[model samples]
Target: MSLECVHMPISPKNLLVVSHRYRSFQKDPIDLVSPYFDNVYVLVRFNKFADVSKYVHIPALQPFISSSKIDYTNKPLNLEVYKTSMFNLPLDSQYKKLGKLHLSVVEKIIGENNLNFDLIHSHFIWSAGYVGAKLKEKYNVPFIVTAHGYDVYDLPFKDDEWRSKIEYVLNSADAIITVSNSNRECIKKLDVKTPVTVIPNGYRQDLFYPSDTFKCRKSLDLPIDKKIILSVGNLEELKGHKYLIEAMDYLLRIRKDTICFIIGEGKLESRLNKQIKLAGLEKNVKLVGGKPHNEIPLWMNACDVFVLPSLKESFGVVQVEAMACGKPVVATRNGGSEEIIVSKDYGLICDPARPKELAENISLSLDKSWDSKKIDSYVSQFSLSVICNRILDIYDSVLSN
Candidate 1:
């Protein structure tokens, strides 16, 4: 499987990117680099919401994604995929083993299509980075791994066995990229010697910018009389939605006009719904199913404030998106929030999972007068175009060696 093509790229060359998610509600790391590579091959681990049986039988790379539905304006990407359920019995010990299948699929595809890529870039450390490490070892090609949050902060500390796997992948990568400064600190603690770069996730200013709040509320049919407190993320335990729901009582006590909306879908919908009833927040809190990605900006524009009370967040892009729309944010002291709310000027950061603290922070944010133009300007430096070029520069640096 040794790919012997060693001619340096005087021009744009092929790039093989391995990741678990893509082109969804949020901006993807691949979205920044795809346009720079001549022909990009994306291998997605089909672990998104649905049952494993949904896309198991389909031929791999059968145009699973429609062209017209692309979230951003980027060059075409050759979308390829594989299922997590195909080998899904022992979910714990088998995920890393499943990564080998990605290599097998890529090798087979290359043999049939006569294709060769200059480098391999992977997203997370566990599955995609492990797969990329194997490819780099077998083919002698460059390998780069970008740690988002969970992989670097949580997974490595799971157990000795997990630590070994993470170390193997880290040792294999030529350069490591993280989205936040705190994420880089986590990497440093791991004693990793690989060249690491901290590249914060950028906001799409085109899709998310300050608009007339009243107009935005009218378009979304949101009540203008009440102050809208918004939290957007998948309704999972990690997101700390229950805590937010609990805070509704305190929030309502202070500002009875405030109503909170939780947007995004997950398995915890029914549980959250039940919690809403038990807490007697039925009238105040709402669990609206997954909002369309395009409509997220409208929610930001319409709401008085945005909140992300996650117990653990790697890099919360929605917080920045809300800021881009000139909305004040109330975030917990999670990994990325420490940097996102670095100054009181951007937003407020309080203790995580504490309903009272969260309630107080939300109240403070609601009362504060924010300058939308300042928040917009603060987030503009992390625009998608700037992030894309930063990645391309990294690619150039890695390839020259």
Candidate 2:
């Protein structure tokens, strides 16, 4: 039998996209969605350099696929797609001025190229969504906004002023997309009724998956004999790393050989370091700081278990990434983890801030005999291609109406 490929109805049109992570193109959804559009213009926030890595290593960099000649030597790597261009905000600027900046940019693009975009898509509900709503009103184009992690669980509920702004943005959009079921509920709480769809952020399998265990351990200079337990997140209060570190007391109480590595850097670094020092876990638990995004899979492969102890998570995309790496996870009962860790075979779940429960689950996960292949198979639906197709379906549905 011959196989034929069927795709969603494709219309070649210009797409004006807004995102906060355009500089880090590897995880940007626009990097995946841009290929399907004739042109995609990305407006990104300009900030201090967080990483020293060269732009050439960006896995999503597609210079040849772009329509503009952008100088990559610049701090912010800009690009074009049939007509896409990424603009970084001027220093000493704020997102509150995004509407003004977007108006100026759109005026120039429409006048110079005589272009009219079919729709606008924004990532995150703050600056990007705010600008998308403005463009929708100014140009009368359909708009879509996706809320990820903190944007869903923190911003809207943080203050009444923020709630009002976010509510208006969601109410104004033609369609709303959230990364987790937990976020959909948060949107509903705003009392705005625009259709909300759950589309999780997908992980690239090429970047995150099971690899040669020995080489992975050797590359990271991690010992081969220890039972490694890993947690990858910023050392923030919301991440609940303090509790994970507390749980380690119980872990070490039983198994002296077990080690924990907490990755990512944040303001809470000093506090977490103090916690480790006070607990006398300096050797048992190490703060590896932030590693390159591509190196995360090596840690997952080397570690026996991956744990995310966030008190409240929107989607916990990293947990799915852990699952794809063929390692079992011990995550909290955050909305996202509850859906991902549906069965005990994948791993175990406990309350977010409970050290006793977390330690128990971690112990149980360590003792469990997990089938790596089965663990990897469970996350097949969250692959980048599959998630993008579902997003495209949403795009088609919105445009057809």
Candidate 3:
């Protein structure tokens, strides 16, 4: 549905969004949702003591350091973002205490600015959702939390203590919004009484859309003759980049014409590089570090097929972005990819972490003739306007009652 068809209330409402970062998947929805609200107050939480660059001396790890700095020059007009930091030592044991500490920081910001909102919409469970839950108690506002990826599927199930903490944050919210049915099922495992809704994450249509393959390849200086496979995501363990590298090894043995480009930076870069070297895929698989978010579309358009070899995902929005660019996807049956590539017509889905199966599917995707327009048309339902409208409907329903 178009944004024009979305119902708007007579009186304007203000929204407060508490999130981990103001970029990519988190920021896209807020940008789309901003036009519907009078004011969108975004509170971004950062750890002051988490700067690894200051302590670590390794050169390879230098690029993966977490930065609290955010460029606000391009933010939306109605969106007023407040970034706050807390001094929390980087330790796994210290995680549960972060919620209260984060809440304290948010309370200070809200008090100093005298910020008020009709409702609280927070992303993630710990820290942001916890802060939103506490703020709801103080202000008596409807609180909503979106549980994305690791926060839902991985964190809570680690132990009993964490499970209780995650459950408390979820139960406190007026409503819970998870990205996929896979995530919704994870929430159901917790047995929380709060109403849960499945709202898949969306891609920016303006940034990622159908483009000429030859032009995109020429612009990016990529080889026009080679069959290019692209994967854009952090080079982390959960992302399953190593498996993709393995799959590339298998593909190279059959066809020397294919080359895979892995984008994004992380702690696993050195390890993945070693694996690539050992497998003798040095010429085929290129670990082209993180590219700017805007430049991703160019890479997407230049590739023959997009591959997502994630071990687990609440929602793989990158797959949607690739489909938006009119490219066929070869993804593993990670929780989210199966939902997006429901039919083989859209793309191919293989078992996660299996090099042989991933290799077979990647080969099939490369050989198959896919309709670019059909792929683009199929992904339009995941546009920002459609996602934001559904979210707005949830906001209206929560506030009206």
Tell me, what's the RMSD of every candidate? 6.1, 6.3, 2.3
Better of 1 and 3 by TM-score: 3
The candidates, ranked best first by lDDT, are 3, 1, 2
Score candidate 3 by TM-score against the native: 0.94
TM, every model: 0.88, 0.83, 0.94
lDDT of 3 by residue, 259-358 (tens): 9999887778888989989988888999998777788999999999999999988889999999999999999888999999988889999889998899
Candidate of highest lDDT: 3
Judged by TM-score, which candidate is best? 3
Candidate 2 lowest-lDDT run of ten: 62-71
lDDT of 2 by residue, 1-401 (tens): 11111345458777777665543222344556665677766655333222212343321222122211122222222235222233433332444455455556545665676666888888887767887898888888889998876776777786776777788888998899888888888777887889998988787766777888889999999999988999987667788999999999878888787999998766677788899999999998898876666678899999999999998877787888889999999999877889889998899999889998898888888888999999999897887767777888888887777
Candidate that beats the other on TM-score, 1 or 2, i.e. the better one? 1
- For model 3, where is the 10-residue window of minimal lDDT? 59-68
Cα deviation at 353, candidate 3, in Å, is 1.0
Give the clashing residue pairs of candidate 2, or none: 81-84
lDDT string, candidate 1, 1-401, tens digits: 11111223336678877776556422354654555567777665543323432455222222222321234444355534323323333366666566666566656666666667889988888678988998898888899998988899988888877788888899889999889888887787775779899887777666888899999999999998998999998767789999999888888888788999998766677788898998889889998766667788899999999999999888898999899888889999888888877788889898888999899989988889998889888887676667666777788888889
RMSD of 2: 6.3
